[model samples]
Target: MNVSVSRNSSHSEPRSLLAGVLAVLVHLIFVAMLIFGLNWKDHPPEGMVVDIWTELPQPTREPVKTVPSKQEPKPVQEPVKPKTEPPKPEPPQSELPPEPVKSEPPKPAAPQKAVTTPPVKKPDIALKQKPEPIKEEKPDLQEQKKKEQEKVKEQEKLKELEKQKELEKKKELEKQKELEKKKALEKQKELEKQKELDKQKELEKQKELQKQKEKEQAIQRQREQEAKAQREAEAQRAAQQAAARNLVTNEVSKYKALILAKIRSRIVMPPDLPGNPVAEFNVTLLPGGDILDVRLSKSSGHAAFDSAVERAIFLSKPLPLPPDPALFGEFRNLNIKVHYRE
Candidate 1:
């Protein structure tokens, strides 16, 4: 028993050691995972950089108009001043060419400040440049207006396209929702159908099991009934056989009494007999109750009484017997005992 215990301990030690090692490894792995997760979560989120343009520098066409606006009024020629006088005050600085050309609509106040200053007159050389600059500025302003109108149309078109895309996305989402709903309904219906079939099968299975149980019970009951009936019949037959045996025993006793009485009557007692002596004989008889043979089974000590009893037995040739042929076997061989003195 000790050796078996030691062997069991030896076998279990490695398994226990392996389990302990695995537990330690799992703990280490869990700790590592925790460390990694903590380090990953602790880091700060990166910043997003955006560059905002405060002013768009239009240096090509806008420089010409802006420079002229600042310098042209400084050199207002005396002859051209009167001719351009009506047009100068009439043009509001808010509707300036720089607004359309440079795309700086919010800086309209800056241009109004510049344009509000009184014209500074220089020499006659600046007079000739004034009319030419005014002619060029007129055509540039018209072209700028047309470009601004085209930009507005492009913005409207982009907005309409974005709206159409949003509507299409909505439609697609609705369609997907409808499809998902349909699939869910179909799946639910299929599950219901499968459940119903399972229920039916279960019901059928229960029915079959019930039927089988009833059938087994019926078979068992039939077997028990048959066994019971067989037992009853056997008991009845045994009772009948016992009664017949008792009747035969009673009939045989009755015939034995009659034989003993006849033998007692025939015996002649001897006067010289001292005491009563019992004499036993084995007698063989024919079916007619006639003595076939007689043998002394026991002697009475008195010789005269024994002789007289034997002679008397021979005289009574035909003895009484049962009338039933079936009872003749009982009287075929008889044992008779007689006593003298009565």
Candidate 2:
């Protein structure tokens, strides 16, 4: 078949195989120099066949002989000197024995003399200062804002001096209430001028008691007009002396009613005054009428009841004298007033 495969014939190794293609092209150049030394960057990849070699079935041959002998080697030993005396130095072994007595470490006490602290006088280092000029805080903040505006103008002049001392204590309490209302209007005009001078001294004492009661009523009407003109001239001389002494106008009116019932039975009264049962008073009579003035113009609290109304008006003294000397001035002004009403 004219075959030989030594190597390159454009790879397909068939043109009659040249020495098995030159051992497969020396194992494919040892696998392309181991893939270009493990492929750095060229792009030549794909050819894989690496089987190395193992198909063997022929290797057998044998025959050859020869013998000869010779020998050598053995020797070594040299120190030898006799012993005796220098062993006396064995006494130095007591060195560790000396350490056993380590009792001396306590000698450190002898170094204690360093306690002398007396040199401490070094405090005079007071020299580092010099830094002062920083005071302009804006003129101490404008003198603390002018001492807070002069403490707010002394608190607004103490609130306008406490509102002018409260308007001078309200004008001194309204001038003490207008001087106590002008002293109560001058004590009500001096009590209305002392009530008009007590009504002009009570109208001049009631006009002097009505002019002494009209001059005692015109002196009792001129003593009753001279006792009625002496009773009409003794009644015309008792009718011409009763026609020449024959006087019997019914026994001259029965002895003039028995001398007015004997002076009204002695006009009694006094058991302490106030009487009025008819014996009122004027019983005096005679040119010689005895009981002159038995006091009480109006008395009653008495000296024995005004001496029992003056012994009952002197027991009605010479009283029956009414033969009419014109009724003797009505018993000569004998005013009496006794009133008792059991």
Candidate 3:
């Protein structure tokens, strides 16, 4: 039960604190609203009237002194009333003037009480006091009017000052708003510029990639053209080489036939040559196709036919050769075969 009570109290404490905070907030909001909503100049404040009384009237002393002085004059006049029985009615009328005489009576009453005060002196002094109060009251009223006017002028000056301050505050707030707007516009412009720069960079990258691709394609085409040119040149060179070799072989064969025909034409056959026996010869020649040396490598099995072939070759001194000097190597050494025909 104690714990539950404590919990309840704690909860109540927080709720009270929250309520207090809300109340304070509400009060602050109300004050702020009043500050903004109320106009100072519309309701002019009342002018303060300050009384600066230089001299205060002795009304208390006047009342006290006048009462006793008027009563004392009555006692003195009552005795005089019997002394002057013929002027008894005049004495009561004389007492009426003493009421205003109280202004100066207090100053001379103690010394002049036994010496009967003059009747003419009381009426003159009383008349002078009445005019003096009237004169003092007139100046007091004028001074109060002046003070009120001055206070009003001061209030107007304060109101003007407050108005000027409010105008300045409004101008400052407008300037701040304009500055904030300028800053926001500049930030937005910067963001747009950044976006443009990013776009330009992307375009440049794409262009660079395109250029690289074009260069690669051009390079591949050039390489293909170069390879085709190389292959054609190789085929033409092989064909030319083969044609040159065949031409050299044909020239060599023609020269060999000429040489053998010349030698055979010069041969002198022996009589009764038996059944066409064959003979072979080994010959060495010079660059000019001159027979340098000749040897019989095979006999015809007839000594006379072999002797005839050997003699025929020596008689044919320089053998026939190809016109081209490059073909001389083929005729540098020669092997010849002959047949003896009857």
Candidate 4:
């Protein structure tokens, strides 16, 4: 159980750990929900009421004054003039016959007395009674035409001013609409920029998380490989130790036979050797199978034969040793006996 736990812990990924944590949290939330009931109903929104009351204006009352009473006019009394007595009737004179007068001869009559007559003076009343000059029809008509032209010019000027004002108002409205459109476009662009920025941030975060996960997995794999290699090394070391402890003599003999065969193949013997003789040699070897020394322990009493054996040993250079380093002690100073037969 403990080994299984350790193995699971070593191989578990972050995703699995997070899932387990989430599962626990979900269970806890479920239990909490069961213990405490939820209140899901929403409260109703409050309403506002507005009342409008308007009062009617009162009528104004004027002050009343008493009027004076009218009086009846009195009748006028005219003064009476005394009536004058009629003038007395004039007396009538009786008519007489006309008398005939005789003609007088060439008598100069005396100048009649000059009668005195009052001088009559004419009244001189000064009054300005000059006759008014007659007005010309042509000049009056021209003046009327000038006044009509001035009225027409004033009406045209008023119309032009109204047109200019209308045009200005239209231009102002167009400018306002354009400004609103520009502001809307700017707001949209800003929103798009913000959205792009958020997307970029999210992508970067995901990339960082992926990279971290990969790094962790790589580290885990490295640790597993290292552990496996260590285990293998330990097992190999133990096997080697066991094999060294149990050294087989037959295995040693096989190595010795291989060494002898190698040396014999390189030996150059002389034909004049008398009888078949056996030569014995003690060879000192290193753990790596390199010969340190070769000394003649027993000889066939032939110098040439001894010399040939020495030369053969020298030519062999590095001798064959046991494969196991622990068994190297057996071949450190190996003794070999060789026989040459004709």
Please report, as a residue range, the 10-residue window in candidate 2 with the lowest summed lDDT.
60-69
Provide the clash count, candidate 4.
Answer: 0
Write the candidate numbers in order of decreasing TM-score. Answer: 3, 1, 4, 2
For model 2, how does the per-residue alpha-carbon lDDT over 1-342 read when each residue is reduced to its tens digit?
234444445467456577788889998999998998878857666676566633211110000011001110110001001111111222232333233222332232122112111111111121111111212445666556656754765575566557556655654565556445645654654564455446445544554454455445545655566577778778878877886345444444454455445544554544544444322344333465655554444445544444454555677566454454544554565544443333
> What TM-scores do the predictions have?
0.40, 0.23, 0.47, 0.32
**Cα lDDT of model 4 by residue, 1-342, tens digit:** 999999988985669878999999999999898766543323454564545523211111111111101111111111111111111110110111111100111121111111111111111111111111212345565456544644564465456546555644654565455446645755665565566556556654664565455555655666677789999999998898778655556678888898998888878987777779888999999878788889999997887888888889889878887777767888888898878862
lDDT of 4 at 152: 60
lDDT of 3: 0.68
Candidate 3 residue pairs in clash (backbone atoms < 3 Å) = none
Candidate 1 residue-wise lDDT, 3-56, digit = tens: 999988877544788899999999999999999978975867667566674333
Backbone atom clashes (below 3 Å) for every candidate? 0, 20, 0, 0
Between candidates 2 and 3, the one scoring higher on TM-score is 3
Model 4 vs. true fold: TM: 0.32
TM-score of model number 1: 0.40
Q: What pairs collide in candidate 4?
A: none
Worst 10 residues of 1 by lDDT: 116-125
